[model samples]
Target: MASMLKDLWNRFAGGGNASVHEEPAAEAVEYKGFRIRPAPYSAKGGFQTAGVIEKDFESGMKEYRFVRAETHPSKDEAATFSVTKGKQIIDEQGDRVFR
Candidate 1:
């Protein structure tokens, strides 16, 4: 019947009770002195790293460096070194200063 056909069409074509969702993925964070890039293939299966950190101590002087912090294979970690000018360097915490 017409009703039966319409029901079948609605079931297949209509967005009814289907679950719309997505898996959470890692995020990137940028700072004044550095930019963090996602590197999911590192020792950790899902982790991000600082692609480049530009530091200009004196005028017309530039330097680039890479930094990594200790973290679980799945969770995000802080940078091993300071990524910005205002950020503090705490030694008591797990934070490190990589030169």
Candidate 2:
């Protein structure tokens, strides 16, 4: 009875297999004068995102931007799956840029 009570207490106190799972960090990729890194398990459904990263060469300080690459299923062709919506950031001149 004592062992069972202890086990119950441990479970309620978040001590029995309630540890947090840490995901692996993603490597940064450079493109168009900006670096992009994937945020680990931060999306709505445990998916990673391509985050814009900025680094200062002199101080080696890093910054993370909120803009991310996202894919959405086509509403019109949900069954046929003809097209997918993609997220993008554009500049005033209609050029793709990292936010």
Candidate 3:
């Protein structure tokens, strides 16, 4: 009964179920040696990436690199680019780049 009224109200409001279809959010993709994780959709109707970098100077000392897809137009592209860059950095810096 409640659903019927809701459906009737939707039809009257011009927001009938016929015109309502929710699109599934984009899933993260992994490419090359990088992992691309999808984030929640933004108000602008697209997802935005979040980048984080961590470094520890205590004990064994460690540095972590976390680059998100914010700079790239797509998540897969970002992951590939980031991984390539990371590989270059590691190759150049060696063990100093991490713990």
Candidate 4:
């Protein structure tokens, strides 16, 4: 029971299954002067939809990360969805997304 408790603790604490293989993040795509990188991660039942948006400024750089409620059975689909959602966000908010 001790080993089982330890395993449960690790899983809930985000340190379990270090040997499990993780999918590589999708390639970053450029859109309207912004860079979008899909970075979906494995979650229960499916891959979670998430990504990062970045822009370069004269002074430095800005970045924003987003996670959506959507989930997909395949990592590729999740990544594609992440990019699509990122494009929508960029189109809707532009640089305001940073704030």
Write one digit per residue (lDDT tens) for candidate 1, span 2-99.
Answer: 97455434433433331111111233344444333332213334332333323345464343333334333442342322232113322221223334
Report the C-alpha lDDT of model 2 over 20-47, residue by residue, as the tens digit: 1222244455444444443332333333
As for candidate 1, its clashing pairs are: none
TM-score of each: 0.25, 0.33, 0.35, 0.76
Model 4 per-residue lDDT tens digits across residues 1-99: 898567535533447552112333777899999988887777667877778888998978898877677889998998899999999999999999988
C-alpha RMSD values across all candidates:
18.4, 13.4, 15.5, 6.3
List pairs with backbone clashes in candidate 4.
none
**Rank by TM-score, descending?**
4, 3, 2, 1
Query: Could you say which candidate leads in lDDT?
Result: 4
Better lDDT candidate (1, 3): 3
Choose 1 or 4, whichever is better by TM-score: 4
Between prediction 3 and prediction 4, which has the larger TM-score? 4
Worst window of 10 by summed lDDT in candidate 2: 78-87
Q: Which number leads on TM-score?
A: 4
Q: Report how far off residue 54 is in candidate 3 (Å).
A: 12
lDDT of each: 0.32, 0.33, 0.39, 0.77
